[model samples]
Target: MVSSKLENEPTGKKLPRIEIRMLSFDLVERVEIARLLTDAGYSVRNELAANFDRFESRVMDDDWDVIFVDARVPYDSVSRALDLVRAIGSDVPVFALVDSHQENQADLMELGIADLFTSDDLQRLPGIITRGLEASDDRKIAIEARRLQNEIEFAGDERAVLAEIGRLVSSSLDIGQVYDQLVEQVKILIPLETAAIAVADVASDSVTIEYLSGRELPGFDRGRVMAMSGFTSINQLPQFVFVFDTELMEQMRTEFPGIRELLNAGVRSVMVAPLVHRDEVVGFFATGTSTENAYEPEHVAAVEQIAAQISGALANSRLHIHISRIARERETLIQIGRDAAAAHDLQSLYGSVFKNLKNLLPVDRGVIALKGEDGKSLAIEYVEGLDIEGLRVGDNLELLESSTAVLTGSQPVTVDNAANREPFDLTDGKLITAGLPSTMRTPLRARDSIVGLIAVSARDDRAFTQDHLSALERVSNQISPVIESLSLLNQVQSLAAAVETTLDLFAITDLQGVTSYLNPAGIRLIGLEEGASGVGVDLKDFMSPEQAEIVSSIGLAQASETGGWQTEISITPRNSERPIPVELLLVPVRNPSGGPGREVTTVNVFMRDLRDREALQVELREFVLTVSHELQTPLT
Candidate 1:
């Protein structure tokens, strides 16, 4: 039989050769295929269709444009050869050459054969070759197009995942943020039914499921710790890929069921990548799909890259947390320093420390204890925002504890738990009664001497770190100077005797008009007996009726305004019927909280008698009047 072979030209010029390889059953079919393609301008060759293994390699290796197979071969069956090329993952097309129709002829067509040809149709051989070349070319173009599309889609998905990863690295609050972003991004790489990230704690010999996304598996809430050797085995391997049928899954469950709960629900295939940083395995990211054999090699590689990124991201998150904590501590101490600088008394100073305490450190309840005036005990000087039984202001306790060491200029005493153990005995029952189980006592120092103690407390299990102690030390340092200044007030008061002994009359008064203290000179000037009771008397009572009303107005106005005012006024002494002149100066003390005399606490009054000046003025007036009357007598 001869098939139609269309000749191009008889012009002796050789056409470009088209190469062809054919799989034939016997010698007859081999010669037929060779001549058919040869007359059609294709250079043809023949191979004995020896075995299905060699058949698959040749077709899949891209050497042939079209493969022609005989319906029967000496050693192997046609159906088996066709199955090798199509049922598996090869893309080359195969056609069958049938000699006669059989009972299974229709069944052979359904076995993924590309086309069928019979011996009677030998004339159509050239047509079949022409059509096969055209069809193969079309399929190659389509496959190339699909491959490019997949690459582009993968690239787009990578960009989106990396963008989200950038956000996680830059703004992550905790490791949980990194976990959240990692699991969500894993689903983009493959068909994911469920995904999880589990971190292994070596010391605890446990695996902690840190984050999970998609379908929830029973007994796999976050933070659940499992005692399993599977995580240990996973850590030993850099990566593990598991694909299971129902039988294999059951086998795995029997072998390692302890960690089976950590696996994804309905998982048929899963890829696990180790989260490694600096050569240490910190955790693993598990991505699972319910579809059988769903994960490919490329998917495993993609998950490996994500796990690597998460390792670095987690480290950065910890650094960010530390930096934010330091920044907050600095701002809080600066505010406390400003408040302490304005404190003029111990009470306001204590209030400022407590108000800003929580800004720098955790404080649920706090107290400031200082050595009492009794000199043998420490007293509760300042306390609030805490409900401690048997503790109040002025309550005394023996100063024999680690806090007493603060009086000797020692470091602060700290306790992690107050119920069973504490640094000092004096703090006994204080924490349990206050509902606080953690306590820290920082010393308040003035002029290199311990002036008081600051105690901060929190709920049980609140462990204070060294960083927290450092921050508290910064706050205590800022308030030390204010305490030093207040502690020196007794030395300041010792100078008052100098003012008292001077000939000047010095008096001190409250914001009201009544005098609080009167120097001896002031007492004598007001006609009160020396060392007599003049403290309660108002200065207005000794002034003449007109001067009293006028100077009283001047003094009241001086109290209302800040600074000082001075005037000379006449006063009728209580012991004498005549009025005497005196000089008076009123000065308002500074208000601690700011502004002018609105909150002023006291007024300072200085007085000096003007009796000598008034006597001289009277004599001069008499001399002037004498001369005037003499001149009016006409100088005879």
Candidate 2:
């Protein structure tokens, strides 16, 4: 029967659940110890030697707080339990329940028992159990603290290794050579049976063994290409730690088939350190051994640190063939980010991105396209590479007809030789027509979705290398959010621009009588330049003394009513002493932003200049008079 929770016991959250494992041939002895531990608020488990197979499995799989054993039992002795625990490397403490203190005391003490109590001492069982649990908890804390300390030291070492690798990346030009040199340098720093570096091709979504050292892998060859399944390990391996036996290796086959293959070929242990580029798991730096228990946690950490440095060096090598631009690029990114952040509209934001991208790579033409409304089409948002007039903003193109198909497929696409590639296969058809040599397309990724596509073209054959592509990708990541923000800002600015340039004079005055906005026509009516200090001035400054008196008393009071206020009034300009007659319309602007009762910070005012209407009336009167008096006399 399965064990169930005790009714009187507290939940695991409030108190630690104690698990006691018993190993004894005598049924009476097992019952006594279990009942004693249970009465003391512990969860007890019985492991009678009547069925040794099930008993051994339970001891191995479950975490037992303390194993109480009949030390010299005929069928299942405490020595047998000790032998099993040592074989499996279990840390569970063993306590011996000896019959008497007289027989073979030296042999019993050598069994590595945690504590020994005479069988007659039932009174000491409670005290013995309590002390054992306290010691167990202390041991657990000490182990965890030791693990954390090792991690801290490992992190420090990784930083130093990364700094060294940074220097190597800064000075090196050849990526292959940098990786080869890194593998050699890692061997000197870390002990391993074999170490190899595998690099993933972004376009191919496949991995190839780039560098190899140590014991030559029997079946696996250098430059062997395989699917993404071969490269990715199931668990996010931190310590490159996998100890292979038959059962453990087989269970892991589905996630890491290639690693399993190595284990099957008489390999005992292995660890994988990922070669990451811009937070991406591009490939891995792997180390394996033929001897079991050969690698430790510290070794796992050491290899990972070396791999990280190699990854950074490899990524840096690709940026510029002969020139080191990481320092300059870092500064450019900071400045460009500052500039991009100020973009209140799409045009300026897109202009900044494309202009800065040219300094980063050889971008003869650039295209920023996005997924269309219907979900099946890709629409061009901005174009730069060639004269792509047909693929203008809002022009919807079929996803299959463009290189953007690969981007949405969740991988990058590159065309080294545009002449041999299909014209339609490329995102922009004009690339081939204009004799452009190479093109690369990558997804413009945002937080929750792939917002758009970014494609770049070059004029020279195979112009865009891995380093150029990485730089472009880095640029894409930096600008994706800015693009999204700018897109939203452009829509809002368009609406605001329409209101500002309208024929009527408009202004928003706050509750405190300060103007916040004076539109284009409002600025003209106020006789001030666009950038002048008209915005912070009071509404009374635009009205004559008499008009101001009427507004301060009658107009303002009437506007407070629910109907709002509208009447013709005389207005004064800042530059002129003369007052002008104009019709005024005022409406209260509500703040739906928060709070109660249509709370508003400003009132929107519209004033239509009456001068044009007044002139038209005069012209109509002159025409009527001339026809009635002058034309009647001319008829003779």
Candidate 3:
């Protein structure tokens, strides 16, 4: 028999509201009984005139804690009504209303009437009502306990299936494998016609179907992709990105147009839940069933719980991939630095540094330059990214010239939108023209002076944080000292190997004005006598009258105290018309006894006819300042 009270089952609140149904032979008695019951806080539904049809409807539609049947009704008519109630199921504990003077009370009690009571003894009605409802409530509780036991057994059978699919998803890190297992497992657990896994694309902010299973529904485009903002995913998905359930299939379709055709094609139900990571939606799972009312609230809730558990695992896998790529790039940079240090020559250093770094870092171009004369001008030793003629080799770009300003300070300089700024440096112009909206330049310094620079550019308006800037700074710091050492080693090797063939003058002197060592050019420059030997030869003997006193007073004295000194001294050659201004640098040599005794010192003297170079530098500095000031006028 179909359960008639399926929709009207008493919940916790209704359990205490006593309900009574009155079946009587006449209208007056039934009306009186209903009024009395209602006044006593009992809900009463009456069926008068002994109509068996009315009684059956009342029994099927209403939840009656107690049934009041009049014993004065015709036997056959009343029996028919009683028989209908019996066929409907379960003993409802009917109480037959009898008069105080009625005969055969014991027989009536035995005739399936749980209790018989007169109308005059209405004081006992409250107790009867309470007892009946309690008894009915007890029966309902037992029925629920048995139903729950059956559901638990069914769920146990499905556990094995759920476990197998869960194992597959957990073992496979590939997204395709996880999606395939999801669809297959859902089909086994619940009867469904269609299923799909949709993941959000970070770049586009759109959702695309990564996996789909089951046949296409008739008269509909079953597997059509929905836009990210559409109803297919949002209506079914919970706002919390964890778990939720609802059973309004028809209402969902009416609210979202894209899924209307699917609903009309006998696919009446759907459930969806988001796959979340770090409190954000990474993806989602959606399912559709062809049978009407296929998914209950419990079914939706279970699917949501499973999605929540697996989302965190998938997020971990994604993070691992990102870290692996970054580690590989760092290793490649270390190898390049090592290779450059091994070059042992300027040309080799240029080739290794440029070629290897281009492969290691993502950039459009690079240039290396050395500071010339008090950080005034930079000589471009190497250039990459375009034709060589496009770049001016030896020139002074300003200290605050666009993103390349890293050479002026020990920091990384970044420019996100170079085009918006007026008067930008042209070396990075190609990157801007090609739509590279961001750039980073790292300074390479030696002995606290900017020696060179390394730069990288990108095509997106990306914000680079302090961490990225610090990483580039660290990379440049490690390479700068190694580069300086390699250059110094090369200089030492060149001098030792070509000593005999070198035409440049070399000289060494003792602290007491005695000449210790001199090459052939040094002897010719000073016009030394043929008989003069190295030992006990006063270096003051080579200098003219004025030069002799200047060296004795200033050169040797400062060399002893400061360990090194430099000055320009006038040299009057034998036939020269005017005194030659020769640049002299004195380097102190360590004493063999390890004391502060400056027994020997070396001086490198170079004579340069720099009558115009000094004037040009002054003119260039004045021109640059004037132009920069003029350019700033309109910008303000």
lDDT of each: 0.63, 0.64, 0.56
**TM-scores, all models, native as reference:** 0.44, 0.37, 0.42
Tens-place lDDT per residue, model 1, 1-636, is: 111222355776543233434455556766777777778766554555455666666656544455667665532467666666665665555666775754555766787666677777777777776786667668879989999999899978977886777666557557675565666666677678878777655555566676788877776666556654753364454445443444555567756764365343566666667666776556667766667777777776676667777776655554677798888887778878777777777788788887887776677777777766565677787785776666778777787654455454323333423433434547576665556755666777765667676777776433344566677777767877676566554334444455456565667776555787777777888788766966887877777678767656766576457355767887777789887777766666555445433455666666666767755555434432333222211110
**Candidate 1 lDDT (Cα, 0 to 1):** 0.63
**Model 3 C-alpha lDDT per residue in residues 1-636, reported as the tens digit of each score:** 111121332543342434445565345655666666667655444444245666788777755555777776555544565677778884777777777877766766655667776777766766776666667678889999998986786577467656766686678666465666666766656656777666654445456565677866543232223455555444444373321123455556676564565666666666667887776777777677756666665566567666766676566655654475467547756765777667666556655665655544454555666555455545666655543344445544444434444465433223424544433444546555556545666678866756776555544333233335555566667667766666556654544343324333344555555555554544555555554443444545545678767766787678658755556666654434465555455555544434456354343232222234475445434432332222211110
Ranking by lDDT: 2, 1, 3
Which ten contiguous residues of candidate 2 have the minimum total lDDT? 627-636
Clashes of 2: 4
In candidate 3, where is summed lDDT lowest over 10 consecutive residues? 627-636
> Residue pairs in steric clash, candidate 1?
3-123
Residue by residue across 285-367, what tens digits does model 2's lDDT show? 77777766666666766766666666766655544533556766676677678778887766676777778877777888888
Angstrom error at residue 452, model 2: 54
